[model samples]
Target: MVKKKIQVLFEDEHYIAATKPSDLLVHPFKARSQDRRSLLRSLKKQTDLYLFPIHRLDKPVSGVVLFAKSKEATRLMKEQWNSENVSKHYIAMVKGVTETEGVYDFPIKTDKGLQEAKTSFKTLTSNDEYSLVDIEIFTGRQHQIRKHFSRRMHNLVGDTKYGHSSINNIFRKDYKFYRIFLHSYQLRFIHPFTKEEVIISSPVTEDCIHIANDLFQFDLTNIGNEAKEN
Candidate 1:
């Protein structure tokens, strides 16, 4: 298999933002017996810099991931993340038609026990089969979006763990989509050093655009283009 190069969205002395592909681990996991590829190692090899992950995307999810160039930068960025100052936005294609706009104010169980988690979503378009929605997460809980949507019976398309296999098979058979239909579309936070507000966004993947067009007749490409212009 050919290696997919990580797409860098923004980079500077203090930080780097890149698009992570699905199935790529942000850091090494000790539990997995087999040696697995990691995004941190790949980025370090590619840039020859000591990069520190300030935030993470789940292994099966793709899109905007942030890293700090130095430990000090990492410390500063983590402050923003821990304080809930960072704004995370995502675009997802799910199994059922959701409400036009609403918040999933639910708590999720973690190693630390139950924690308050909330996600706000607005349906961009939908058909009888599926809904395309924009999601904004207020708390960074493990698998929060997936769990919230799954609990509502609107699991994200291609989510193997929380989604129905029959629904996943439809997309796999029809559109050949195997990865989870969740992308980290945008990230907004204050630059720790400069005190400047920074917003970084990644365009929807081509596969996602094609699937949305074929399934719901929604043009995600146009939406991505418009976002670039703004």
Candidate 2:
């Protein structure tokens, strides 16, 4: 198979931020024995440098992912992440309309047990059938956004794990949309080396825009720019 190009959004002496395509793993896993192609490995081949993953996106979710260039940079970035100093923002197209703004302050179950997870969301636009939401995650528990939104009965579009199978099938058949409708739109943090504030963002994929327009008549032309500013 031909390799998909990893889209680099930002790069510097200490860090790199890149857009990860859906269905791609951030790192190789023993559990996923057959799936060895990962973003880290691909980046290593491309840059020919050892890279450290600072954060991860779900295999089926596409968007910005951060990596550190060195062990020290990784340590510093991980410290910021653990302290909740890193700001993560995402855009999700969901099954139903939501309030103008709301927060899902709930605990999610993990292998270690239940952990506190908080996600805030603002409705950007909506029709009767679907809503485009801007989400800010306060906690990084696994599948936090997907689980929280599923609890609210607004499972993300094309999310088979937490969403309606029929809806996913419909999109797949009609629009050829197969990936979850969640994009890691923005990441903001203080640079570990420069000690300066940095913000990085990724544009919504063209497929997502086409699906939104075709299915809901929603325009996402300025969403990326607006998301970066806010």
Candidate 1 — worst ten consecutive residues by lDDT sum? Answer: 221-230
lDDT of 2 by residue, 42-158 (tens): 988988889999888988898889999999999988877845667898989898889999999989997679999889999988888889899999878889999999999999989
TM-score between model 1 and native:
0.93
Error in Å for residue 188 of model 2: 0.7
lDDT of each: 0.85, 0.85
TM-score of each: 0.93, 0.93
As a TM-score, model 2 comes out at 0.93
| Model 1: colliding residue pairs | none
Instruction: Report the C-alpha lDDT of model 1 over 198-221, residue by residue, as the tens digit.
Output: 778888888998988887778877
